[model samples]
Structure formats: C-alpha cells, structure tokens
Target chain A: MKELYSLSAHELQKMIAVGEVDPATLLDAIFDRIGSLDKKVRAFALADKTKANDRLKRASEKKLGRLYGIPILVKDNICVKDEATTCASKILAGFRPTYDATVIRKLEDEGAVLIGKANMDEFAFGSSCETSCYGPTRNPWDLERIPGGSSGGSVAAVAADETIAALGSDTGGSIRQPASLCGVVGLKPTYGRVSRYGLIAFASSLDQIGPITKDVRDAALILNVIAGYDEMDSTSVDVPVPDYTKSLTNDVKGLRIGVPKEYFIKGLDKDIENSVKKAIDVFKKLGAKVSEVSLPHTEYAVSTYYIIAPAEASSNLARFDGVGYGFRAKESADLIDMYLKTRSEGFGDEAKRRILLGTYCLSSGYYDAYYLKALKVRTKIKEDFDKAFKDCDCIVTPTSPTAAFKIGERMDDPLSMYLSDVYTIPANMAGIPAISVPCGFTANGLPIGLQILAKAFDEGAIFRAAYAFEQNTDFHLRKPKL
Target chain B: MESIDSKTVRHVALLSRLSLSDKELEAQSRQLTSILSYISKLNEINTDAVSPTSHPLTSLKNVFRKDDLKPSLSTDDALKNAPAREGDFFRVPQVIEGK
Candidate 1:
C-alpha cells in the first residue's frame, strides 16, 4: 500500500470523504513522515505541530470543504494568521502576521490543513534557496545538490512526499525552476489570476502565487481554490474563474503546440534537451499539431527581468526601515543611522547586491538609459509572446537549462546563477500562465521539467496539454530514492 | 560600458540606505560591473518605437473602494510585530535635532 503521505491531495480528500481514514489519522501519518525525513530535506522554515491538530478537531464534526482534511504547505512569504511568515529572512524573524494572506484564507475555507511554512530565498531574491537565512533545502533526488529555488523548500517537501501539496509564489522562475529540479508539478498562474494582498513583495509586477504538487491534476485542483480576484489587490483581474480540474482531459487531439526555438539553444544540457523533445513527441503522437515558433526577444528576458525586478524590489523594500515592525538595529545615534544600520545588518549579500543594482538603475542619470530602456525591451518581449500566441495554442520549453547543480557551485557567480532562469522568465514578462511538469530524468536520476505556457487566463489550455503529456509518461510516477 | 568602482558602489549603497564595509564595496563593485555589462546587451535592441510597459497587463485602471467602515486590526494586533513601541505608536530614533 502507498504510504499516507505519498498520496496526492485529491486522493487523500476522497479517502477522508469516504470515511476510510479520519482527519487525525491522515495528519498523524504526515507528521510522522516529516519526523522521519525532514532532517534530510530541511524544507520548512517553521512547522507547527499543534495547528493541524486544531484543524483536524474542527474538521471531524463537519462536512469538510473540497480539500477536506488534506495537509498542505505554504511558502513562507505568504502570511498565515498567528504564524511566523519570515520569508526565510532574519530581518523579519519572529514576526507573526496578524491576518492570513488571501490564498491562505481561501485554503482554510476549502478545509486544507496548514501544516507548515516552507523555506525560500530571502525575500524571494535568489534563484537558489542558498540565500535563505534558514539555509538551503537539499534536493531529495541527491542530497548533494540544491533544490532549485526561491520556492526550493516547497517543491522539495512535495517531491519527497512530506506534504500532499504546497503553495509557492513565483516572481521570475521561483516556482517552475525549483519544481523542475525537484521533480514535481508547479504552476505560475497569469499575473493577475491570483491575488497578492498578503504575499511579501519581491517584484510587485512579476510576482504571482501558484501550486506545487505531485501531479498536474492536483495542481489544477489547488488552482480551483486559489485562482480568482480579490478586491484587496488592485492588480487582480475581475474575470470569472472556471473550475480548472475540468480542464484535465487526456485527449489533447488537434491542439496546437508551439515549441519555441529560443529556449532550446546553447548551454541547454543534452539530457534535458532530449527529454523535453521526447515529451513533445508524445504530444504529437496524441494527435496534437506541433510547430516551431520564434520569440525573438528571448535573449533580452533575463536582462529585462533583472532590471525591472530589482528596480521594483528597491522601492518595495524601502518599507523595512526598522520602524513599524521586524528587526531593529541597536546603537544608532539617529534615524538615518538607524535605517542604514538596520538594513545593512539585516539583509544577506545577494539582497544588498540587488538593492545596489536597483538603486543605480533607478538613479537620476541612469534611469532612462537602464531602467527605461529595459522596460521598452520588456514591451518587445511581451509582444513577441503575443505574436507567437496568435499562431499557437500553447508554447512549450524546458523549464531550466540543466538539472539541479551542486550547492555553492554558482554561489560566487551571479550571472551564471541568473542564466538558470532564462527559459522560465518570459512567461512572467508576458503575464501569461505557465506550468512545469516532470518530463524525464538525467542519467544520474535528477528530474527534468517540461514547461507549457498559454495566453492570459488560458490556464485550461495549459492544463489540458500538461495533463495529456503526464498521463502518457511514467515520469510523474517515479519517486526520488531518499 | 562604464565600470563600477568602489566610489560608485558607495554612492549607490548610500542611496539604497545600506551600509557596507570597504571589502564589501570592492567585492560588490566587481560583481555589479560584470552584471551590468551583461545587462547592457539590452541596449543593442532598437526600442525607439516601443512604449515602455511598466506592467504586463494593459487593462488595469485605478481601483476605487467605497468609504465605508470595515473591521480592522486592533491597536495591539497592529503593533504586535513592532520591534519598539510606545503606547499606541511605534518608537523610533528621533528625527528632529532636539526637543
């Protein structure tokens, strides 16, 4: 029999609803699994043993919501009432949010148990989870390697079956890259599909929240609960949300799939290239029409993303001046000194580097030359996607250039670290929905991800294609040997 | 492309309100120079006719809410996370020269 923790959220929900297992039993099995394996994974920033029990007690007496009694992990950047939402940064240490993020509220309403807060790159600033103050989350596939990050801990936990599913925010490739490396299903909804009311700001414009799960159907199920508009977030769209699970059809016959030529270029690993191409062939055999499409501005995506993300980050992070909340520096003689001391003492190296880059880009003399020019290039990048979508229903690419690299390998090399996000950042730039599903594995057994992107609010199209690809392959069924 | 030096890094760090040591400044200057050089590739593309898009979505407008009363956090909950607090206000280093 499959272990309780190994079951997907949908499977657990059905089991609980049919009275085969009680909420307490499921919770106990998960906590027990965490007790056994979390020491190797280090996937959570904070795990609350008491909270899930309280939720279980309440769930037993009621006809639970759609995610009835299922345990789920949330990325630390998202707020959960009375829980420490540190975003894996020491600056926000011991800070407990007084209210829940919109997604957390939605999860509660759907009867999902809040199991723990997963670790992340500090303030969602780095590609690898190494920048996290809590330390890096190791890849379950090989403990020597990193789980690709900022949502590294969330994806790692789900891949190891430590949780049924998780919620993570993607500002560039935080969700998809890590999900790809960790061998799980991760999705980044259209920019405005999910509300960002209480998600800690990284780059306001590119940030979005989505799910990481064992398979694509669970991703669709979680999206059904979290993807919608909320009045509190001004950027959230008012479009009516469809039941995403209905999009999980195995027959993707006659669908148009666009394989972008830009993503399969130099520096892509041969193994990853082969796996993604093989996955595309499966789509073709399923009666889907495949064609090559060009996203001409693709090379500029990393440059444009770095400029816009950090520029916005510099402005948004100015709120952490050691006044209203969080860490405060001691021995400051005046307010200005306090601001300087507090921020310098609190943030990590990568954070400071990006902040400086942002300050320089937005400075008076360089604003037009750097920030403004990048924005115009961003327009071209988005237009590239727009024109490409005119010819294809969905675009496919490898989620990362390579599988998870050894920790500390690119720690000192910032540009090489930035290049890892090359294939995944354009979707965020275009404000479109995209997903990463396990396509195949490397010879050493590290997972490779196949990314599928659709036009805005066309998550159903992404789901249909991803589901069809997943059902025909055994990649999603393979578990990491722990 | 212009090279980032220690002096420039100091200026940028001051603007960002981050204090750094000399060693940090030197190291960061080297890294930033390389990163900036890489990003300079964007300048090669002609964006003369392109209007800068600050946001991806084109349809966003100013969202307004009615001025109706709503339940909000209590003063205790609001100040719960503050590192330093006095009564109902946040306590911080004095801004003015003297009282």
Candidate 2:
C-alpha cells in the first residue's frame, strides 16, 4: 500500500483502468499519505478530503476521464469555486472564489481530483516561501531548509508525496525555481501557452501557470490538459493545443543544444556547473550536438526584469486596493482612511515594498526614464535569444545557480534573492517554454536542476529534450529520503 | 540613477494607497533606495535607438471570444465571498460625496 504513493498519476490511472487497483482505495491511500506527511511540511492551506471523497464517489459511478481519480494540488493563486483562493495574502485571507479558473475547469473536465490549495508567497511576491501568510514550507529533504517560492507549496506537496502533481504559476521563475529547490520537474510554458483566466495577477505580463510534477512525462501530460485557448483571457493564444504527452519520446538525434557562455561565467557554483556539464555530456552520448552560444544581453535580464515586472505589477495590483473585493478595515472614518488602513494591514512587507517601487517606476516623471528604458533593454534581450534559437534546438543551463539555500540566508538582502532567479527569468520575459529537471545533487545532497528552454510555442522541443534527459539519467528517480 | 528619499517613499506609498507607519517608511526608504541603486546599473549600458517591448511576441493581435453571453456566476455566488457587501452591490466606503 505504501508503494501506491510512488506511482505516477498516469500509472495509477492505468492500474485503475485495468481493475488491478480501485480508484477509491487509491484515493484513500493518497489521503492517508497527505494526512501523515502534510503536518510537518505545511504544503496545503486547505485539503478537501470530503470534497475529494464525494468526487471519487461520482467518478466511481461513471466513465472516468483521462486522468480519472488522480489527486492534484493547485497553488493558492489559482481560483477554484467555493475554495479559498487567497493568493496567500492576508487581504484575501478567507475569501472563497466564485468560479473555477480555466485550468481548474479543464482539470475537472479531465477527471483530475483537486486535493487542496497549496501555500505560497503572499500575492506571489517573494522567491522564498518564507513570505507566505500561513508559514514557511520546509523542503522535504531537510526540514530546516527552505522550499523555493511562490509555488513552493505546490512543489513541496508533489515532492513530499502529499499529492501526485500540482499546478503552479510562474511569474519570473516561481514554478521552475521551487521545482528545482524541491527536486521535482516543473515547466513554465510560453506566456500564452496556458490560459491565465483565473490566476491572481502578479506581474501579469510575466505570469504563466504550468505543471509541477515528479517526472517530465507527468508534466507534459498535465500541460496537455491545461494548455488551450480561453475566451476569458485576452492574451491567450488561439493556437491549437498539441498533444504534449504524445510528443514526449527519447529521440533527440541531431538536435542542437545551446550552452550560453554567459550562464557559465563566474558566480555559478562549481558543483552545480560540473553537474550540468555532466548532464550535457549525457546528451552528447545520446546523439545530440552541443555548441557554445552567446546571449549578449544576458546581464541585463535581471535589471530589465525588475523594471518591467514591477511596473506591470504596480498597475495590475492597483485593483487590490480595498475596493473591488478582499479585506477591509472596520473602523475607517472615511473612504481614504478605509483604503489606507485595509491595504496597510492586509498586505505583507515584501508586497508593500514592491508596490512602492513599481508605483515609482510608473510615475509620470520616472516612466520614460525607468519603465520605458527597461522595456527597450528587454527587447534587446529577447532579440539575443531569438538569434540564438536559430542555431540551437534549445538552450540548456543550470536551473538555479546553486541548490536551495537556508530559508533566511538571502532574504535579508533582496538583491541576492533576485539574483537567484537570473537563469530562469529570461524565459518568462521572452515568452518561451522551459523546464527544470534534476541534474545532480550538491555534496550535502540537495538536488540541482538543469533547465531546458525552447523557442516560443515550441513546447514540443522542450518535452522531447527533457524526456531525453530523464531517459539517460537516474537523477529524476531519486526522491528525498523524507 | 534615480535618488530615493523618505518623503519620496511616503509620496509613492500614498499614490499606491498603502498606509505605512513612520518606522516602515524609514525602513522601506532605505531598502528601496538600495534596490534602485543596484538596478540603476542599467544606465551604463547604451541602448540607443532601441524600441521598448511590452510583450515577447511581436504580433499584437488581440485574441477575443465572441460577445455571446455565457452563464456567469450568480450575483449571490459572486457576493457570497465578499468580505463586505450591501444589497445587490459590493459594500465599499463612500468615495464621491466626501471627495
């Protein structure tokens, strides 16, 4: 029965279909796992055991969907009808959503069971899960250390076997970074690859919701279910949703992988660098060609990201000012007082700081100087990637500079925290698909991830490359000894 | 590089509708100043004659669904989750007459 926890969602469904295992029994085993493990890790804000059981009952009565009876967790930022979609903010602390997010609707249509809302950085602001209102999520590998955020809860849940897989939003590396920290496979699909209809805004221009799972195949399977056109989101692309799972195979012969010279520069941990290099050598052994490439505007990614992301965040967050919905102060003498008091008491410190910086950047006087300049620099950075993609099938680099650090190690210094996201942020900015898979582990045994980035809407290439890597390496199979 | 100060931080906070205490203002002022200074390194790069980009893809076509009415959440369902509400409306504080 304990081995049931090790089965992938796809494998479990197949077992259920063959009548080798019962869905309700498997669901009970999953619930038992969650009940036992979730207390220490603090992954979910709410787990709907009753609702999941009821859904399982209904599933037993009828023909099941592709992912029938597969239990999944979603980031708090994604809306689910009648569930708390707080985005892990005090302002929206007890607010239940009125409708399911597009992704949730799709998940329901496909018969995937939503177990709970995972914790996250309040309003998805911080890179470390420490900023969550509930409490920090501990990495399953080492309880004292941090799980990366704002999707830390989702990643941690999947890593700790609390759930089979999860949906996470990536705004400047949220999904991939946490996935890296927690030893899970995470994908940040192209900006418009997945519909953003129900995701709470956090740097809207950069936000994308993708899957975090234990393997590349599972990630691709979830992406296939969730990726599609949605009328609710204006930015959603109307392109056809290809069968991402079907595209995954261990075939990368003659594929060109670009190794960016800038990413290999100083500041990369020697262990992480060596691990990624070894992973690339495995690709070479699998019949793929690797070449050094240049993204000349590499250094500017962090700077440009800060400006654009904040500027857009400032504008999008304007809606949360104690007006439309969410938290409100009780003793306000007037409207302005109400607005001031509610927001001040509601938002966390990091969120407050970002709103100020973003507001300043978008202010009339500084708009051209900061926001506009960052935008222009961002164009150059995208152009660099565009040029490089012409020469390579995908770009490969260390997902994070090093393995997950202790929770408070870099939080005091925001700049250092921001630098941790350098390798992954460029994909969000350029609107390309990317994934982070376990490449190796640090000497202390924390997992390191290697990122694979593909051209816009070319998730096929990413799936193919990641599957190829997983096939040649045992890194993805090593679970933390939690 | 842009200079940051306590007064500037206060002004920005007000504009952003966030009421911070004097102590928070002081701390945030210092923090924002440092972050701004670090990010100001972009000033050294010469991005002359480059166009600003808002989205990664160049095609600016707006993908829209038809204006057909689909079932939206009921008003009761929508307001069921509201922290504060009045009859048929979300209960926010008065803004117009006082202003």
**Which candidate has the highest lDDT of all?**
1
Cα interface RMSD of each candidate: 0.9, 1.5
DockQ for all models, in order? 0.87, 0.69
Residue-level lDDT of model 1, residues A411-466, one tens digit each, is 99898999999999999988999999999999989999999999999999999999
Give candidate 2 misplaced runs (Cα > 4 Å).
Answer: B96-99
Q: Could you list the chain B TM-scores for each candidate? A: 0.91, 0.87
Residues A92-161, candidate 2, lDDT per residue (tens digit)? 8677777789999888788888888999988888788888889899899888888898899999999998
Highest-scoring model, TM-score: 1
Q: What's the CA error at residue B30 for candidate 2, in Å?
A: 1.3
User: How would the docking of model 1 be graded?
Assistant: high
DockQ of 2: 0.69
Cα-based RMSD of the predictions, in order?
1.0, 1.6
* Whole-structure CA lDDT of model 2: 0.87
Candidate 2: residue A56 lDDT (0-100): 72
